[model samples]
Target: MERGIIKIENGEIIIPDTPVWMTVGEMSDLFMVSAYGIRKALRQIFRSGIMDEHDAVRPFPYAEGCYAEAYNMEAVVAVTFRINAAACRRFRELMLRRFMEKSLDFYICIPAADCNHRTGYDAAQVWQERHKLS
Candidate 1:
């Protein structure tokens, strides 16, 4: 079976199309990490309550009369945060920047006083506080 296309630009990996599921081997290749490492990270992710296996993983028919465990995009992102690799570092940076941008955009849409009153703090600061990993 053909794995979906993956692109890396400016050290960040991107899946251009939706509904792209990747196996452990494929994700290991994409992130430049060992397959064992990927599996370990996945287990840690599940253990940490970051994501549920049933929601993140599914069975994919990779070949005739054969199936492999596949991971969804949310699982990919969660693992990216858990693993230690060059690609994972870059991906985390990209995700953090995007999250901050979105928080700032949301802040701009609301009055500063209203935002403070609604969240009891600055939106960006709240986001940073909530997303601090380790």
Candidate 2:
């Protein structure tokens, strides 16, 4: 949280390092709501001007000459903030839980050698030798 604003180093909600894409139908299923309802809520969120249509909705190819409304995490987060639905709240909670889990995994998995290697050439030399990257 740099300067009191939430900044995700890698804002990939699903795979941690990969972009997350969610179709409107899928989100409706997750939220246990109708697809039209979800779409309406999203449109309201968009009208608030927190995010642009490009950032919120995208064309997702589902079949030949067919496209569906797909949303990214940014849009989902914004919608969750504006709505008071229980399902939306639950979705936000799950997202937060997953984000925290991924973040913890990232910190725990950083190699000690790699951490030391950033300090000096001597450490880098040692790290290289130990990892056989020389």
Best by TM-score: 1
RMSD of each: 9.1, 12.2
TM-score, every prediction: 0.65, 0.55
- Residue 69, model 1, lDDT: 93
lDDT of 2 by residue, 13-78 (tens): 343344556776776665567878777878887787777888666677678999876788787677
| lDDT score of residue 76 within candidate 1 | 82
List the candidate 1 regions with Cα displacement exceeding 4 Å: 1-5, 9-12, 98-134
Tens digit per residue, CA lDDT, model 1, 58-80: 88786799989988878888888
Best by lDDT: 1
Q: Candidate 2: misplaced stretches above 4 Å?
A: 1-17, 97-134
Q: For residue 36, what is the lDDT in candidate 2?
A: 82
